[model samples]
Target: MEQVLVEEYRNETLECLHRGHICGVGPDGQVKYEVGDADFVAFLRSAGKPFQAIPGVRAGIKEAYELTDQEIAIMTASHRGESFHLETLSHLMDHTGLEQSNLVCAESYPMHRGSREQIIRNQGHEQRVYHNCSGKHFGVLSYCKLMGYPLEGYEDPGHPVQQEIVETLSMMAELPADQIARGTDGCGLPVFALPLKHIARAYLKLSCPELIEDEKTREAVQKITAAMHAHPEMVSGTNRICTTLMEDTNIIAKGGFKGIYGFSLRQEQLGFAFKIVDGSDEEWAHIVVSILEQIGYANQQTIHRIRERFPSAIRNDAGKIVGHTKEVFHL
Candidate 1:
């Protein structure tokens, strides 16, 4: 139960430190590697998007709408709101006869810097579809439409869509529905809280859908994961860690708000998750790279690619090398 020092920021000296927990579990729910308390409880945040999208996929939304792999990827995405992301979302809404007005997520600018700058140059206002979580909201609304459920209170925990989300998560996590704690997410939807291990367990099933009992759920999981792998750009965007990592490897990775990251190794059938105590998203990539290297899931070349793309090097105004962040943890 030892807490590990996950990252360190150094200038002329060590300027900051981040401590967190990392847990790796096999398919059987046995802890294969641990840095700190694997049982630490936290909200899954956007890391739960894939599971949340399960209900829609299981309800035949994909087949009914003739959704493409790119569309399915966005349904489980925390996209950066680039033009392509916006276009894909618009296509989905158009197909369903829904509009941006139906989205429960608040209006926000794109997370992609270039896209944001372009929108600003055009004097464009923030829109609900530009929100990073809009695709997830769309998934919920699509589920409501497919199931003939009411759309007004789809965000409510008592809503059928929310209940189905909870049930799907419980089934995947192998935990009872009542034991999962509930809270509101950043996007105005219910987010579930459970132990880190259970989250890992859910990712395990995501990585290997053949383990699922229900044929429909299993197929949905397979389709979603395949879509994520095939179109990582739709899942996030250019230069995003989740997108880059999934693009370069066979694994499926997702990062949630508040410094939580989860991934499942397809070859090894292993699920891994971690959380930074201080919730510093900047430190996530370094920690994940370290974990993959430590566990031998990724080779040195892949690690080098990630570091090159998502460098933790700190620089000054002149672009001089001022400092850098280093991973300090090991399995």
Candidate 2:
């Protein structure tokens, strides 16, 4: 394996390095490009939400709850917990006959700075509903309600909802269910561990769901991908890399905890997944842009927008430019 320095951070006169592995796969499950150890195993974290939501969508939760595309997008989100996000979650819970109390995720303040400040100014305490993973938990609850399964332990590996999620992920990844490892997420849901290539394969299926043989799975993937693209804001937020990337190009992207980022290119039917070994979110946006450029998917306009919106330049207290972050990877 070759050394892949994904990003470099410079401050005045010193540089810090971030290294990682990246893998790109086509619809046929063939590795199209790779850097470093493409087989490196890691937890998917929230990057798996879109796939995890497949079972619920296939179970008719979308039709039953009359979920809008924006709402469906939130279901697959690691949102910024903006006011709009909370309102959307509230509406989804209302349709499902659930309440904030029903959510199993731990309480947390909003991830968006403005939302957090507003809540504090209003003397409103943090609630489970404001947690970034609340939408995902709500989707799990909806699945439990639709199937009449016990919602109390829905996050348990033995639970039917979790079992179905695993099965759905397995089908999409073209891997055996038993081969997929499991772990607990920050939101107390079951997260998956697999090779980078398998994760890329899942995203490839998401981009080209028509390639799936099962009618229900295909329909679910199509709906989820459409929702993410149509309402990118619900997937992340106004200033997030995921939202900006999807909005600017024909790619559906998502970022997860521990520096996991994945995206699928709709026009090319390709999927990419990568991990920053140091788990630094700061390098993620830069690496994503670099990967898109390397794969020949980003246009000049898209590159300009990304640079304008996600500048990695270091600035002094007076906002003077001191140094910058740059991509160092060849592919």
Candidate 3:
């Protein structure tokens, strides 16, 4: 069952409410807090990028291509194709000798308004590298190049590269490989579906890798998380929640399409996954703030940043404050 996690008010009367499920898990893989159906199954979408990049890291793609942390960060990013994102991606391809054509993700203009407008002004065409998932594809392709695997069917579930990723996600989620439901992502990559609690567990392992028994997996997690920390902007563009939360250096987070989001706190030793039943992401910041407040998160600076960027005050087309949003859930 879903709970009313946020409510929007216009002229002091409730105008809209968002129902969602939130599940927080501890390092011990036990539920710490929950507000709705903890067992609700949802697709991980791009929220699986970090875990999907694990196989590449394990294959030593970083060393093989002499990739920097910024380059590595892009492999786990849903970047908006801002100028800096393009620059970093160019560097990554140059270093690895990867062609934009190698990425199977469909070509599209930059997701950032300013960047897309700039390209339109110049009459530039869409390119595959501009797709948000291109980095993940490049990471897989790089791994395939290193491992002597065929690149033609790399996106297929039965492909060797994808096989490794499945094993990695299964190990990280602490679930058997066959137990995870599978689906094709918008970018044409295989995506994982699991209960919210297991998704939280996977993020918990991501933030607190010491709990992982396997040494190699721990190292890969460390490298990936550290890359995300060192280059939060590469993980997502400016004003994105993922970059904002990770900028605090204590929170590890990523949001996916269709209102799916996952985050972890190192100090709290907790991981959380939330899904908005209506599939709206507009109130994500409000819900995140409410969660932090309920959990007594100690990072005032991080909370303040989020509130500053995404205040409760709602605005109209002319920027007039006309409404407000408030948290409705207790946990």
Worst 10 residues of 1 by lDDT: 1-10
Find the candidate with the highest lDDT and give its number: 3
- Lowest-scoring 10 consecutive residues by lDDT in candidate 3? 281-290
Task: State candidate 2's TM-score.
Answer: 0.96
**Which tens-of-lDDT digit does each residue in 1-331 have in candidate 1?**
5465554555658788788888889978788888888898878999999999999988888888888888889988999989899999989988777788988899999998999999999999999999999998888898899889998999999998899899999999888999999999999999998888888889988887877899989998988898899999988888788887887546888889998889888788899888887887888788888888777764567688788987878887998878888888878
**Candidate 3: where are CA atoms >4 Å away?**
none
Model 3 lDDT per residue over 202-221, tens place: 99988999988888889989
Residue 153, candidate 3: Cα error in Å is 1.5
Q: Candidate 2: count the clashes.
A: 0
* Structure candidate 1, residue pairs in collision: none
Segments of candidate 1 deviating more than 4 angstroms: none
**Superposition TM-score, candidate 1 onto the true structure:** 0.96
Supply candidate 2's per-residue lDDT for 232: 88
Candidate 2 C-alpha lDDT tens digits along 237-309: 8878888887854777888999888888877889888988877777777887787787776467777778888
lDDT of each: 0.86, 0.85, 0.91
lDDT of 1: 0.86
Model 3 clashes, total count: 0
**Which of candidates 2 and 3 is the stronger one according to TM-score?**
3
Steric clash count of candidate 1: 0
